[model samples]
Target: MSVGLVIRLIVLALLVAFLVSPQTFVFVFRPLVRAGQPVIYNQGSLIDLTLNHLAIVGTAMVLATALAVGLAILVTRPFGAEFLALSRSLANIGQTFPPVAVLALAVPVLGFGTAPTLVALFLYGLLPIFENTLTGLTNLPPTVTEAARGMGMTGRQRLMRVELPLALPVILAGIRLSTVIALATATIGSTVAARTLGEVIIAGLLSRNTAFVAQGGIIVGILAVLIYDGLSAIERMLMRRTGQAGRQA
Candidate 1:
């Protein structure tokens, strides 16, 4: 096997082993702490947090996609384009607010729970998705769009069949960006007593337990890597299919 492929396999094996281990954390499982480790807790709190991260990130992704697509479509028109600068400015503001602060403010109104966290995440996720969708749509070759219009295609038909397919890759890239940000930020949710992997880190930090923090942080890292990679694989597959179909006679 190629050296790069072999290394990749080894890393994947280690990640899967650590993920499935009873200790559920590398620090807790270590005896002397240098590659060889013993199991501690036969439970997986980190896995639970990983699951929660997925939920938060998924929710953010849905909101981001809807908002970005809406804004992209709206701004494409002459009259609506008047508000393009304003729309982008508002999106910029959403991201400018510190997510933790946003969560803190949301707590009283939404209560101290996942609802506030999701709200923060949704705002955090919006700008990238919205901007990319707009860029992708506007960058479409004029000739191709003109041909679609010449074929008696309605606006919706051109958007759904011709324009959106061309823009799909960039749209998915926005989703990938939002996913990673949400995973990392979701750790903060533990501060508000949310039932996420953040719980492990906060508990450990409060108690000065390195094992808890390391375990929680590492699991979240792995979860982000895994999800990002999984989505990338799906994106590549879809892109290949679309490209091949677009090229066929």
Candidate 2:
């Protein structure tokens, strides 16, 4: 139990405690509100909202990872090299348009709730994953790749066995970045009637209840920090496995 690990555990415990029995923590938030305003977000369960928020982020991440990583793989290969710029442009298009605008445009076609929110998140999250994967694959040590080639490995074999393994830490780093962005950005999904933690935030904003706002912000912040820390640990493990950690250190 390193100090960092201990701190993370404490944060995790606080989050669970808040979600499991929110009223118990009302005293903590009571100071932020007026006499009659509610301290807790009462319309929906915090656990349900958090789960819905995670579901939306997870789905969008899956879609974005598949397309972004696929395109990254394609453009890195000899046959697909010429299309590198095009792939970059395509990924950039997602980030170029704001999620709000994406949702607004998608609402007419995909309608409201989760569908449009998913579209917004998927597009908004693509660029980081794509760029990171591309950077990881392209910047691998020439000698390591040459050794793989010397071992009579096929292009696909080298990619699957050598390249991808070495590149995974970086790829994971990208996914981590994208996921964190999606987590926070998903809050806006409530504007389109999506079931997310954003609903609590929006309600607080609408009713001018600072306590509700603090509650929503705190939960989302805890989630983002935990997920980021978790992903960073995974990334570091992958780097060590691939010997990148030693080289970097």
Candidate 3:
């Protein structure tokens, strides 16, 4: 349909083709591999690795979004106002502690595989979404909220019909940021024996096979770009709708 949509589809097609038959691109990467090394990245199925990577990242994002948004909504309420600073500090913990550090600490408790990675990513993604949600909810025009209350709306009704609608654009921006970051960071899951594209990159690094690194990096980069663009489009659409509503009022 649209040019951007067509471009995204082409990228998705290329990614699928590459994952299904990575060796087909051997010529593109042959020069990058060591003299005696095979040009293809054959450690595992790229498709499976990509799917697993997406699943881990998606799970983390869902968890992060739920927690962050809920906490943001909580702190903005009168009953929870006093806990704003505490909530911020808690969200900041993930950013303060590196993913590697989180992973290392979690491995002992979670015992490897996807569990540790999920924890790390969930923590890492919390700050942006939480901060953005807080900003969106807190920054609404007082007049609009007052109007909703004047119309005999309950707190829940005002929040659902008035506050959240206006805040959706800003909240979506946070989600966009979180999702993009998670897509790239999920690669680190491979260190804990989680199947991910990071395995290819790590393998390349260990064996000095540039092809592996390049392919892994390319796929991750493409995925991030695609997701970022898609989320951005959604954010823009929401903003447009919000603007239209404002003008109508």
Models ranked on TM-score: 2, 3, 1
Better of 2 and 3 by lDDT: 2
lDDT of 3 by residue, 75-171 (tens): 9989999999999999999899999999999999999899999999999999999999999999898889999999999988988999989998888
Candidate 1 TM-score versus the reference: 0.83
lDDT of 1 by residue, 1-249 (tens): 877556656766776676566444445446423342223322345455566667877877798778877887788866588888888886776589998999889999989878888888888888888888888789887889999999999888998899888877777877888888889898898788676778767766666555666767777786677667767767677668667335433
TM-score: model 2 vs. ground truth: 0.98
lDDT score, candidate 2, position 69: 94
After superposition, candidate 3 runs with Cα above 4 Å error: 1-3, 244-249
Alpha-carbon error at 151 in model 2, in Å? 1.0
Candidate 2 lDDT, 153-239, residue by residue in tens = 999999999998999999999999999999999999999999999999999999999988888898899999999999999999999
- Candidate 2 overall lDDT versus native: 0.94
lDDT of 3 at 116: 94
Query: For this target, which candidate reaches the highest lDDT against the unseen true structure?
Result: 2
Alpha-carbon lDDT, every model: 0.75, 0.94, 0.90
Number of the candidate with higher TM-score, 2 or 3: 2
For model 1, the superposed segments whose C-alpha errors exceed 4 Å read 1-21, 24-28, 31-44, 242-249
Worst 10 residues of 2 by lDDT: 26-35
